[model samples]
Target: MARRFVTLDVFTTRRHAGNPLAVVLQAEGLDTEAMQAIAREFNLSETVFVLPPERPEHRAALRIFTPGTELPFAGHPTVGTAVWLALHDEAEGGGTEMLVLEEKVGAVACAVEVTGSHAGHAAFTLPRLPEAVGTAPAAGLLAPALGLDAGEIGFGAHRPGIFSAGVPFLCIPLASRAAVAHARPDMGRWQDALGASAAFVYSHETAEAGHHYHARMFAPTLGIAEDPATGSAVAAFAGAIIAHEPPGEGDHRFVIEQGYEMGRPSQIVLEMSVRGGALVSARIGGSAVVVSEGVLL
Candidate 1:
C-alpha cells in the first residue's frame, strides 16, 4: 500500500525555514517499529504518523517520533499536523476549525486558522503543565558541556534547570546571545550532565527587535544536533519564565527568536496566564507552510 505524506516548515510563515516536519497520512497499518524506521528515514527533527482517533470525537491520533525515539507529545508536530489537516479539509469544504487530537500524554485542543488553501496558523494548549523536574548541574559542569565559560552559564535568577511539560529538557540560561550562538555540545559532558534529556539554551538578547529572547536547542541523543524551532521546549519554558521572571498577576506574551545560528531563523509565540503568583495556563502558536506532498509505496 502507498501512504500519503506531506512536509511542512513549522513555526514560520515561510518555507525553507523553521523546523521541517514530515507527516504520514493514512498511516493506519504501520506499527511502532515501522513508524520509527520511517522517522529515521525522514531525518527531520520530527515526523508525525496520523492514525484514526481512538475516540470518535477527536480529529486524529498522532504518533510523534524523533529519529531516536517516540514522544508522548510534541509541539511542532501537533501544530504542523493541525494546519495541514485543516487545509486538507478546506479543499473538501471545511472551513477554519478547532481540532482535538489524541496523543500519548492526553487529548490536545488546537485552534487552526486557515486563510485560503495553503497558509495557516495553529495554536494549542499544553496537554500537561510544565513542572520543575529537578535542578541542573552547576555552572562549572554545564559550561564545559555546552562549550561555554562558567561566567556565561547564567543570567538573572535563571540558572541551569530541568523542566518538563510532557517531555523534559535541561534548560540553560546564557548571559548573552554570543554564548548561545557559540554553543557546541560536548558529547561526553552532555552525557554526564543531561543523560538522555535534550538541551534547551536561551539568552535575553535577540536578533530581531520585537523578539523577547534568542534561543537554541540541541538533542544529539535524539539524532537532532540542532533544531530550527522547538514548540515543546517553549511549552516547558513557560515554567522557567514564570520561575525566574515572574510577571504580576495577569497574562503575558513573549516572542522567542531561535535558529539564527543555523541560518533557519524561526519565531515562536508563547502566552501564559499567571494568577496568585503561579502559572495558570500556557499556549504555543506559530505559522506553518506546506512545502511538498507525495505518496510512499
Candidate 2:
C-alpha cells in the first residue's frame, strides 16, 4: 500500500527554509524498523509517523525518527505535524484548535490557529521543565571542537552547560553572532570533546533586528550534521536562560533567529513565565509552510 507523506518547512513562513520535516500519515502498521528506514529515505532532520491515538481524547500518537535512530521527542516534527493535522485532518473552519499528541516522551498539547491557509502558526507548552544535567567542557576544549578561540566561548553571565527539557543539549554561549556564524564543528575533535552531547551554540546578537537571539545546532551522533531550527533545543534552552539571564517574575518572550547562515532564515518564539524566581512554564511557537506532499510506494 502506498503511504501518504507531507513535507513542511518548520519554524519559518517561506518555502525551502527552516527545518524540513516529513510526516507520514495513517502510520499505524509501520513498525519501528520500517519507520526508521522510511525516515532515512527521507533524509530530513526528522520524520514523524502519525497513527491513531492510544487514548480516545488525543488527536494522534506520533513517532519521531532521525536517520540514525528514534527520538523520544523533537520540536519541529511536533509543530509541523500538529499544523498539518489541524489543516487537513480536522475541519475547524478557521479558529484555534487544540490537539494532544502522544509522543514517546509523553502527551504534548499543541495549539493551531487556522488562519485560512495551508501555512499556520502552532505552539506547544513544554510537558517537562528543563533541568541542568551537567556542565560542559571547559572553553579550551570546546573552542577547538567548534573552531573558535577560547575567548569567544561565552558572554555576560552565560557559560557552557548541559540542559534538558525532553532532550539534552550542550548549550554553549558565544560572545557575539560573528562567532556563531563562523563557528563550525571540527568533527575530528567533536567526539572526544563532547561525548553524547549535541552541541547547541547560541549568541545574544541577532541577525534580524527584531529577533533577540541567534543559534545553530550540530548533532552528528543523531545523524543531523546541522539543523536550521531546533525547537527542542530551544525548549531546553530555557534552563540556560534562567541560569544566566535571570528574568523578573513575569512572562518573557524572545524571538530567536536561526538558519540564516544556511540561507533558510527561521524565527522561533520562546516564551517563559517566571514566578518566585523559578521558571513556572514555557512554550515554543513558530510558523510552518507546506512545501510538498507525495505518496510513498
TM-score of each: 0.98, 0.97
For each candidate, the alpha-carbon lDDT, in order, equals 0.91, 0.91
- Give candidate 2's TM-score: 0.97
Over the stretch 105-186, how does candidate 1's per-residue lDDT look in tens digits?
9999999998556779999999899998977888898899889899999899988888899999888999999999999999
**Residues 1-297 of candidate 2: C-alpha lDDT, one tens digit per residue:** 898999999998888889999999878789999999999999999999999988998989999999999989989999998888888855555434788999989999998865546788899999999999977899999999999999999999999999999899999999999999999899899988998689999998988898889999989889998989999999989999999998999999999888899888899999999999999999999988888989998
Query: Which regions in candidate 2 have their CA more than 4 angstroms from the true location?
Result: 90-96
What 10-residue stretch in candidate 2 is worst by lDDT? 88-97
Task: Candidate 1: give the clashing pairs.
Answer: none
Query: For candidate 1, what is the TM-score?
Result: 0.98
